[model samples]
Target: MKIKVVFLLVVELLVVIVVVVVVVVVVVVITVAIAVAVVGVVAVVIAVCVLRVNFVIVKVELVIVVVVVVVVVVVVVVVVVLVLVLVVVVLVLVVLVREVTAEVGYSTGSSVLELVFVIVVVVVVLVVVVFTISFVVRLLVVAAVVVVVVVVVVVVVVVVVVVVVVKVVVAMMVVVVLAIVVVTIVVIVKVFVVIVVVLLVVIEGEQVVVVVIVAVVAMAVVVLLLVVVVVVVVVVVVVVVVVVVVVVVVAVVVTAVLVAVVIVGLVVPPAEQNF
Candidate 1:
């Protein structure tokens, strides 16, 4: 009985050891499977995060591109509008000039002489203006020319009329002097003495000096008027030259700018396609 009991205890110890070994092996396998599942879940989460970040970056870049396109379109439209406005203004000015010229050229049928005079005056004024340095200088020169011309013309006419009227007086004086010369020799001598005395008094007196001074002053006034006219003409000419130079330079620069704009406009993609 003692031996049988000992054998039974040994058998029970072996079965317990085998069962514990089996249970330990099952627990290790289950832990390994759980670790693999956790690793897979972590990998999936990281991949999702990376993909989401890339998607966000792409969306932001797209938005930025869209905003830039919108701004460029707006700028192009504004530039085009401004250029059109400038063209219209230039056209209007050209038309107005043509119309005014036409109207002046065709205005009246009966006043041909008057029209010719007017045309001549206008041409003279334009010539003077074109020669001047600035608009203000041109105006001043034109005014001075008109005033001087009128004054000179009036003075010349007056002098001519005065000379004509004095011709008879000068002829009578000559005849009287000749008659006195033919009269009595003593009477001629006395008359000659009296004339000499009177002539000496008038020529040597302050009155004669005053008359000379007045004549010199009148001549100086005329000379001064002439000088002013010449100076005005010179200034007008210089101004016109300067204006022409400036206009040429401005026209060249504007033409270059226009050409550049045209090139850019043609080369650039259309507004809708630029985006």
Candidate 2:
């Protein structure tokens, strides 16, 4: 019985030792499981952080790409717009050239009409000048006729006076006195007619010169007016062309900038999301 009891006690001690070992093994396994869980949680957290970082990086890259794309697109659009505008301007210039050519044709016709009108005016002026000169000549001739009549009357008066003097002097000395009186009357009549002809010729010549000067001034004024009209037409066309080209260029540049911005927005990452 004593041996049996000792054996029983030893058995109980072995059982207790086995239970302790089992408990220690269970505790170690639980600790290992908790450590594994913690490690997994940490790994998941790290993965999430890494993924968030990557996502942010991607978003930033997308934003950058969008901006770059927008810029590129805008530049291309601007270039295209500029080219279109250039083409339009070139077309406009071509049209302007055509219009100018047409205008030139019209102007040529107008110039021809003006030339005809000037010719008519010149012919009329020439006719007027001729008429004026003829009228002046006629007046001068009339004046010459009057002067001739006056000279004849003066000669008649002088002859009558000489005759009376001769009658009175005849009683004193007859032949020499009568011959001197006749020679003096003839000389005075010739001198008076010559003086009147010379004065009339000089006045008519001066009037002709004045008429020619006035005609020349009128022609010069007509020519000046035509020149001014031509200059104004050319200036207006040039100014219109310049303004059109400037407007087209400005529109193209603005359009290209807008296109580039849009393209960049589509390609690049957003600024707020970028690291």
Candidate 3:
């Protein structure tokens, strides 16, 4: 009777352990699914943000280039107009001076007419030189603006590309780590199941010594599973800070489940009653 009672207790405990394990596993699966979904959403959001940043940066750069080009064109046009007007004015003044010189040479000295003409020529040359220098300076300024725009565009593109690549790499790493963690969980579950079956067989034979020995081994296995989980959590934390939040939640849950199973699954009703 005592042996029968002990067996019944063992069966009840196994049933309870199995139920608890199934529930915990279901919870873990649901949580992992949610985490994966969150990860996918985050990745999509990041990709969209990166594309938007690139678009905005390109649009702003294009506008800047267009504005610079327009300003340069306006400046050159104004300078050319001014130069043309100055040349026309100088030509008119020369023609008038020539007429005056012809008239003056008859009344005034030819030397006086020559001197006035030389001064007029010198004034026109100075004005032309100044205008030419102003045009050249404007060209240089426009060139400088173009070079600055090119450099700024290049730098912005490089920064955006690097940011996007880094984010992609981090996301990939998180997924890989999660896969490893899932495999670990599955292994822990398998080990627990094998240990439970072995216990069922050993305890059925009414071998107290075998049961005690198997129970010790089972405890060691449970400890090992917990350690594996801890190591995985540490690895996840080290690999990426961003993934730690989700992975840590999973680690806590799985560890709790392992602890519960180890304690409950190993429990055996007191075999003190006489058989």
User: lDDT score, residue 51, model 1?
Assistant: 37
Please name the candidate that would achieve the greatest lDDT relative to the true structure: 3
User: What number of backbone clashes does candidate 2 have, counting pairs of residues 3 or more apart or in separate chains?
Assistant: 23
lDDT of 2 at 188: 34
Question: lDDT of all the models against the reference?
Answer: 0.34, 0.34, 0.41
Can you write out model 3's per-residue Cα lDDT over 204-268, one digit (the tens) per residue? 85776776678668768765855665475546435444453545344335444443433343343
Residue-wise C-alpha lDDT for candidate 2, range 124-183, written one tens digit per residue: 234333433433343233323323332122223223323322232221122122222332
After superposition of all CA atoms, the RMSD between model 3 and the true structure is: 45.3
Task: Supply every candidate's count of residue pairs whose N, Cα or C atoms clash at under 3 angstroms.
Answer: 7, 23, 0
How far in Å is the alpha carbon of 44 misplaced in model 1? 70
User: All predictions: root-mean-square deviation over Cα?
Assistant: 55.8, 64.7, 45.3
Could you tell me the lDDT of residue 214 within candidate 3? 80
- Clash pairs, model 1 backbone: 131-236, 131-237, 131-240, 132-236, 132-239, 132-240, 133-239
Candidate 1 Cα outliers beyond 4 Å, as residue runs? 1-215, 266-275
